[model samples]
Target: AEVAPGAVHVPDWLDLETRRRLVAACREWATPRAGFRAARLPNGGVMSVRTVCLGWHWYPYKYSKTIDDVDGAPVTPFPGWLAELGQRAVSDAYGAAVEYQPDIALINHYDSAAKMGLHQDKDEASLEPVVSLSLGDACVFRFGNTEHRGRPWTDVELRSGDLFVFGGPSRLAFHGVTKTLPDHGDPDLDLSGRLNITLRVSGF
Candidate 1:
C-alpha cells in the first residue's frame, strides 16, 4: 500500500536465521489459546477461525461463525531482532531518524483457499507506517485508494521475504490479499501457505 512516497518494496530485510526462528516460534504458538471458532460478521456471515495471540489468548471480537474484529487478535510482540528490523524499515521510509518501535505484530495465517477482502487498518490510535513481511507462498496484494473502496487499485506480488510499508497519506488506504498462489514458496523456508507479520504502532 502506497501512502505518500508511493508503494516501496523492501527486499529481504529478514535474514535466514531470524526468519527461520520467527517462523518456528509462530508455528509453536499457532494453537488457539482462546478456543478457536468461526466468527460472525456484521452481514451475518462467518469468517474462518483465527487463533490470536495478544499478551494472552484473546482474539476475535466475538466467537460466532465469523469474526468481524480482524484487528482484535493479540498483537504478537515483535522479537528483538524483528523489532530491530522494523526500526530500520521506519527510518528508511520516513527518513527522519524516527524511533518507531512496534508494540503489536499482527500475525495473519492464510491457508490454501482462504482470502482477504479490501479493508483498512483503523483500530490503532497512531497513524504510523505499517511494516508487513510476507513468507511462504506468494500472494497478490491489492492496494486501493485511501478515499474510495474500489478502482485505481494496484495489485502487487508479495513473495517470501518481501517487505511492504504503508504510511502517511496512504496509511488509511484500503488493501487486502486477493489470493495465495499455492506451491510458490521457498522450499528452504519450510512454510506451506501464507504467513504475514505486520508490525505496527498500536497505542499512540
Candidate 2:
C-alpha cells in the first residue's frame, strides 16, 4: 500500500524461513563486541529502544564506524545478502529496480514498553530509500509528513514480516513507532519483542 508519496508498505513480505534466518543473524549481531545499547541523546536523555548497527555505528545525530557511546568497538559489516534484500524491497515497493547499495543496517529492539518519538532520519548524507523490515511482534507505525512532526499523520499496524520503504519526497518524512503489542508476535519466532531492521545508504 502506498502510505504516502514515495512511501510504501508491503505486508507479509518475508516468508517464515527467511524471518527465522534473519532473527538468528540478529542474535549473533547482538553479541558483546557490538551488542544492543540504549541511545543516549545529547539532551541527557536515553532512548527507550535498544539498538545494534551494522556497517556504521549510529550515534545521536551522526554515523561512525566505532560505537563511542558503548564499548567503542567496530560495528559489524553490512552483509551482501541484506543489500540484495533491500534492493528487492525497493523494487517491490516502487515497481522498479534501482542500484541500492545500502551501507548501514540499524536494528532496533522494541519491548512492550518501548516507544520511539517522531523523528526524521536525516543523519545520513544519502537520500536513498530507507528499507525497513519488521519481525516478531506488531506495532503502530506513525508515518508523518516531511514538514514537521506534528499532526496529519497516519498510523499503520506493522506486523511481523512486513516491509516499509520510504524514499524520494518522503525520504525525510518524520516517522516512528508509537507502541508495540506484546505477546502478539508469532510463536514460531519465539521472540518476546519487536525487531525493526532498517537499511540505509550512509553516503560515507
Candidate 3:
C-alpha cells in the first residue's frame, strides 16, 4: 500500500525461509570486528537501539570508512547480494523495477525496551528510495512529512517480514519506531528481539 506520495508498505514481504536466512545473516554480522554497538550522539547520549553497519560505518551525522566511535575498526564490506536485495525491495514496493544501489545497510536491533525517535535520513548524498525491512517483533512505524518531526504523520504497524520504502517526495521524510511488541517474534526463529534493516545509497 502507498502510505504516502512516495512511501509504500508491503506486509508479509519475506517468507519463512527468507526471514530465517536474514536472521542468520544478522547474527553473523553482529559477532566480530565492529560488531553491534550503540551509537553515541554528539549530545553525549547513546542511542537505545544497537546497530551494525555494512558498506560504510555510520556515525552520528555522517558516514565513515571506519567505526570512529568504536576501536576504529574498518567497517564490514557491503555485500553485493544485499544491494540486490535492496533493489528487489524497491522494485517490489513501487511495483516496478527501480535502479537503486544501497551502498550502506544499517541493521538495528530493538529489544523490548528499545524505541527509536523521530529522525530524517539526510546524511546520504543520494536521494534514492530508502528501503526498510523488518523482522522479529512488530512495531508501530510513524512516517512523517519532510517538513518536520511534528504531527501530520501516519502511523503504520510493521510486522515481521514487512517492507517499507520511501523516496522522491518522501525520501527525506521524518520517521521512527515508537514502540515494539514484546514476545511477538516467531518462536522458531530463535530471535528474541526485533531487527530492522534500512538500505540507503551513499551516492559517493
Best by TM-score: 2
Give the per-residue lDDT digits (tens) of candidate 1, residues 1-204: 333464567656567776788688777655554333344566787655244343322233322222234434443344666678788877775555878777666677777886778888876768878888888888888989888788988888888888788877778889988888988886778787888877877663
lDDT of each: 0.69, 0.93, 0.90
Q: Runs in model 2 with CA error above 4 Å?
A: none
Per-model TM-score versus the true fold: 0.80, 0.98, 0.97
Q: Is candidate 1 or candidate 2 better by TM-score?
A: 2
- For candidate 1, the clash count comes to 9
What RMSD does model 2 have? 0.8
Candidate 2, 1-204: lDDT as tens digits: 999999999999999998999999999999987898999999999999999999999999999898888877887989999999999999999998788899999999999999999999999999999999999999999999889889999999999999999999999999999999987897779688999999999988
Q: Which is superior by TM-score, 1 or 3?
A: 3
Q: State which candidate, 1 or 2, has the greater lDDT.
A: 2
lDDT of 3 by residue, 4-88 (tens): 8989999999889889989999998886777889999999999999999999999999999988988898888899888888999
Sorting all predicted structures by lDDT, with the top scorer first, yields 2, 3, 1
lDDT of 2: 0.93
